[model samples]
Target: MVVLNAVIEAAGLEKTYPARDRGGTPFRAVAGIGLRVERGEAFGFLGPNGAGKSSTMRMLGGVSAPTAGTLRILGLDPAAHGRRVRARLGVVPQDDSLDVHLTVRENLLVYGRYFGLSRKAVRERAGELLEFARLTEKADERVEHLSGGMRRRLTIARALINDPEILLLDEPTTGLDPQARHVLWDRLFRLKQDGVTLILTTHYMDEAEQLCDRLVIMDKGLIADEGSPRELIERHITREVLELRFPPGEHEQVAVKLGRDGLPEPERLEVLPDRLLWYAEDGETALARATAAGVQPITALVRRATLEDVFLRLTGRSLTD
Candidate 1:
């Protein structure tokens, strides 16, 4: 059965921005991107800087119009029904844009009002949201006084003021401590359990793997690949990965030897300044066979393949540069 529960849909969605130079032609930020985010799925955009993630996000949020293509949010055209579509969506931008002058509670109160929420309802929701965000104790405190993580949590609370059906988060945990990041993750997980649709953009592979049910990897305004983390890894890479580090200047010689042996030829091999990675199935078995063949590596570690491995295989480089 082709059950349809998509809340966000895009087809050939494209966006272009004027180049910095006055005489330069416009630049394409998003090119022929097609996506469909289901009602309860946590979808993710995985890419490096300048990968059109933010541009695509803006169009989805109804803040930027596409130069060419179509987008529908909540079954309404984002370009024509922006106000109606925006009312049902929440956005947490990459940069924190909270009103620093207002107290934490006041920030939520004001944002709720923007959605035409009744004052009494806004107040009640503010208290609930503060507890949800774990900022109840800081409700009266100025945003400037809160930690980066606290601010991020508050931003999430503000985004949810209207009980939005879809939430959009752009790098929600950037620059946060481990403890804070986990706290945010826990909150997001709760929302996921409540059946709220989430779309997030992140440079962190672990973040995408942890939270996203499915994701798309974007590179230079194009999608390199799209699938669940496991699907992408299974399709593009092997089950396990082996890392080998050799004292500089010996990798090429070692690589040649390992390639000549009967180990499954790695789907991808990365030569870094300090280490080399071999992507293949059964990393431990591969390592054993390589070692038995006298392919001596300074250090060897076998680990599960990750979304990073899939991305590097598809894009020919690391997501973080």
Candidate 2:
């Protein structure tokens, strides 16, 4: 195994796509971002759609080349040694591309064979991966008959056929139900516990908070902030958030009224279409003050600050936006 402090390193990485029309301006997807992800660390990329997270992942996975700057995977330049670099990396793309005609176990066996493993070795590894993915009971079923979560787990199992040092997952649980998402999260958590370096891009705030040891928030192809979940919240957001939902089209008016010293002013006030987020160290106190000042809302909620708040503050948009 290759041993390195930083399993993945990039300096001023960038990716640009040429415009389709003859006279149109080109679009730069990844705008010169730099990052260092260490071995055995679960690092994440958080961003909305078109924020270049996928583009960055493609470059890091050695599937796409950077338009400019340097990137080193396992201390080897991906541009120069794409094959060797990819051999040690496991990639789970945003969409599952399993061969539906194959049985669940067949999928793994086929992929393991592609890596040139002997028939006996591939069979053994496939058995272990099926259990790890909780698909042992369904091993004989064709992938076309598996549920969404089952197929997702099978995809992950397929990626592990070679026992890669680093696993890259792009939007791992975007379409799953709550229970399915948690089950997948458990599987991912186990991989991290086994000391596999995990690099993932996720739009789910809670998913990022649960899986990422450290993460960068990207917007418009740039890194807005980078830190642990707790650190980012403490740095860019208050300790608590008071969500006040007023009547339709009245939230802005309520925010204006609250800002005129009608209550204990929050550290920051964000006016959204359906609600007003009052950021404060003590949300209960702020809520009390709002009540005393007769700032009645259709509904009110005071909750501890979360990674979603930090993402919203940084990108000025929801995670799915």
Candidate 3:
């Protein structure tokens, strides 16, 4: 690992919440996970709902202490120095926990005071953050009067009140519209360019591809894989994948016949209810050979392999699944 002043480091980090029922085993939200994030890198935890992404993020945010293992953020132990750690870290939660009664700028000013900023200082920072979130026009509007996207942006701007060194985002774009998500992405890109270390959790493959410098894919409370999006895709799958769709019932039958022919057999073949994915170094070659053998697909498409394919290959389930 090319360590450029590691800002976040963990060894066997774990978290467990109390069981809901009496005598039941405690719920293990985050199983042992080891990670290292260098300064100024946009790191991410990519996973589906209930895959321990939130639990792990909570631990990193210093709001919840880990049950076991070790963690260090900015060279300080989060479990021990949570207050100091939080002072230098921004957090945009999955939910927009804005005070409905407060104006866009008032909310930020209030949060900034938690870090002990003077009223005048808080006001100044709130002004800058309002501009950053593109909420200058709505600065005096009550949060309840703002649109969903505007509220989300305000939440992010509020988290920056302390001028934190690192930012933690949990499913930042979960409910936003496409335009809102893109807008958030652009803001996050600027933060990355400004040398602020960021850690975010997301189930969106494209989001990870666009924003993360490095990431870990979590599943069932465990680290399934870790790498840059392209690195993970290349490591776990072929360069190209051919998607062949037929009538619902014919997938298994054709899949059997395709492999039986031994005509440049697919490097990997995935049989799905509606389609068959053929992995190959060259998708065109695979498609032509299949066509020559009278294995006609109702519809065929060839595309580059993606992180989504890597997830499916690793967990036997896609993000939606």
Candidate 4:
């Protein structure tokens, strides 16, 4: 049974794929994991490639069956009642699977018909969705002629044809220009305000930080951690980070030098190829202390800790595919 007020629930979810080669072990895409998403809140699965995010999303959307687990969408078992569950869920896949031959309005209308709506009803909803997607003026334009952002919006509009209670977005803003991304974000934000539950999967740290009320960090088919963006940062990282860039190929050496040279022991020190991140409550003070210890770098910067730091701390890797 679904938990009270939970739109989606999973326990020990697992998905495995047959190996390409004969006599090889099966590939386990999703390890045992559990999560619950309540109504009207935006939840996210944040991870890089091969992190099982897409596999988990496919199961949640009823597109794939879990190998071993209990899964529910809207209080119904997806495996037992896929049609019923899917009817109330909108899916915006990573690819905008819009029909290039169809006009923008036609796309929505056709998709609505698939849900068994009356022709008249579908047309009316299509018009409203076109406006919601900011594509009303382009309603008559064929999708092939529209810009990338417009096509993405049309895809979203089509998914809403059934008035689903939950919407699943997979990398919603990938490949869009910044301006287009912001416009799409505004539309999604409005949906949140209107009490639509959102489940999204993305590798973009900034996107997760901006949109997710709570998120899970997944890696290697397992979840590393879960929490609200700010909570994760506060829990796993310091308040501020001082980035020090040393000479070429010296970042590793500087990581050791900073601590030994009287730099106030930071909460943590992360050494990357490009820079050394000194995690501390007081970034400026750390910088001053480092300077006093006679350490000089090519460049220095101080910035607030973020979700990326939390992911890095948990998974020991960047959130890039």
Candidate 5:
């Protein structure tokens, strides 16, 4: 079993970049963030695009120095002991930067060499990683010949060449199909079971729910909220959600009417292009009340609360937005 000691700690972390124009104005990508990640816990940084998730991950991975504040990874300063800290960390960036000219196994071997591993060790590790990543069958195939999911898995395997104590993944399954995503998730789950500390950034709420033990929601360079998926959902949203679809032009009128007089002014309300979301503590009761109040919807659905509801309630925007 993995120990529960804090492996990563950051206090008042900040990162600001100069503006693109001649004005030299500063753009704060991350601001005053404090976090502690325990060893073997799967922690997630969740936010929409441009919400500083990537920036925070970069700083914690020791690839980018924070503009201010202190960070310690494995009790070592990330800025001062970057090389040493990196040796014990695995990083899988959003973009697959594998060498297309090299075969799958070759890519792993080359990255191992960069870490100063001897040829014999690299070869043995490559074989093991290929099996772990399920790419053993394609070991001799060039990266360019592999599918997107294959390439992504290869990148993940390459990151583990050093047997890192920490694994950092940025959008691990961003563009994969459902089947491919499940395969990746299975691999990640296995790693978690093997006592690997994982830190990831993802826009997919379901992914976070499935993998993270806890997560921070970021917006506009600051953390909006932090908790486990279930905790956040319970705190920020109701137990059930009712979705309704009205006829095309009737949405606005329906929304207005609902806002003016709905079932006890639901916990939260959202009007979408073709539907409306009525969040309430009890879905059946709310639906009954709405129906009794002469509000008729073309279609309706009642579902359990989810992390997406929490994110929307907190940020006032969809995760994709």
Candidate 6:
């Protein structure tokens, strides 16, 4: 069955910023991108810096107008009905924009008031959100006193003041420690369990794999590939990869001899500054053959291919590069 109930829809969506100087061409931040967010699916955009993920998010949030395309949020034209569309969305920006001077509870209450909510209703919701964010004990504390993760959670909580149907989180856990990131991820997981449609943008491979049900890998304002994490890995790369590290200056020499008849014949071979990677169905066999061909490595490891490999294979570059 072809389901058509989408929380956000865009076709040939584009955005261009005005030229920095006169007679210069405008910058195309987004170029003819199309996407659909299902009612309850966690959709994500995975990309490095300058990939236009944030631009697209702003358009969908009803804050930016498309240059030459269509965008509908909650089944309304965002260009014309942006205010109405924004009422149904909760947005967490890349940076935590909490008011440091305001108490945690006060921040939430203030945000709720902007949505035209009654003071009584806002206070009730703020109490619930404080518990949801695990900041009940810090409810009356100044936001400046909170940790990075706590402030992030509070920002997310403030976004939920109107009980939005769709939530947009941009790099939600960028600067947190591992434990704090996990806590935030758990909260997002719970929101997904409650059937809140989530749309997020991130450069972290594991984060995307862990959170997104499906995602698009974007590069230079265009989508390079789209699929679930496992699906992208299975489709774009071998099942396993063998990493071989020889002496620093010897990688080039090894690369010349790799994937030849006398040595390991892998599906693909990549030579980085520090290591040689062999991609194949069986990493052990590839390593064994390479060793037999007079290839001695200082270190060798065989691990299953992941979304990072898929990203590299598709973009001809690492995710961070």
Each model's backbone clash number: 0, 0, 0, 0, 0, 0
For candidate 3, lDDT tens digit of each residue in 1-321?
Answer: 655988889999899999889999999999999999999999988888999999998988889999999999899998789999989999999998999999998899889989999999999999899999999999998999998889989999999899888999999999899999999999999989998999999999989999998999999999999999989988889999999999889988987888734535338888887799998999998899889778989999999988788889889988877
Instruction: For model 6, give the 10-residue run with minimal summed lDDT.
Output: 257-266
lDDT per residue as tens, model 4, 1-321: 534499998999999999889999999999999999999989999998889999999999998999998998999999899998989999999999988998999888888988999999999999899999999999999999999998888888888899999999999999999999999989999999888999999888889988999999999889898899999998889999999988889887777777745545447788877788899999998899779878898899999998888888898887762
Task: Report every candidate's CA lDDT.
Answer: 0.90, 0.91, 0.91, 0.90, 0.91, 0.90
Q: How far is candidate 4 from the true structure (C-alpha RMSD, Å)?
A: 2.4
Question: Residue-wise lDDT of candidate 5 within 4-34, one digit each (tens)?
Answer: 6999999999999878899779899998899
Selected candidate, larger TM-score, 2 vs 3: 3
lDDT for 301 (candidate 5): 94
TM-score of each candidate? 0.96, 0.95, 0.96, 0.96, 0.95, 0.95
* RMSD to true structure for each model, in Å: 1.7, 2.3, 1.8, 2.4, 1.8, 1.9
Best by lDDT: 2
Candidate 6: residue 153 Cα off by (Å): 0.7
Residue-level lDDT tens digits of model 2 in 257-286: 777344353388888888899999998988
Global fold similarity of model 5 (TM-score) = 0.95
Alpha-carbon runs more than 4 Å astray in model 3? 1-3, 260-266
lDDT for position 95 in model 3: 93
Question: What lDDT is reached at residue 113 by model 6?
Answer: 90
Q: Where is model 2 poorest over a 10-residue stretch in terms of lDDT?
A: 257-266
Candidate 1, 1-321: lDDT as tens digits = 546699988999999988889999899999889999999899999999899999999999999999998899999998889999999999998888999999999999999999999999999999999999999999999999999999999999999999999999999888999999999999999999998899999999999999999999999898998999999988888898889999899887777777734444555566767778887777787788778878888789999999988778888888879
Cα deviation in Å at residue 16, candidate 5? Answer: 0.3
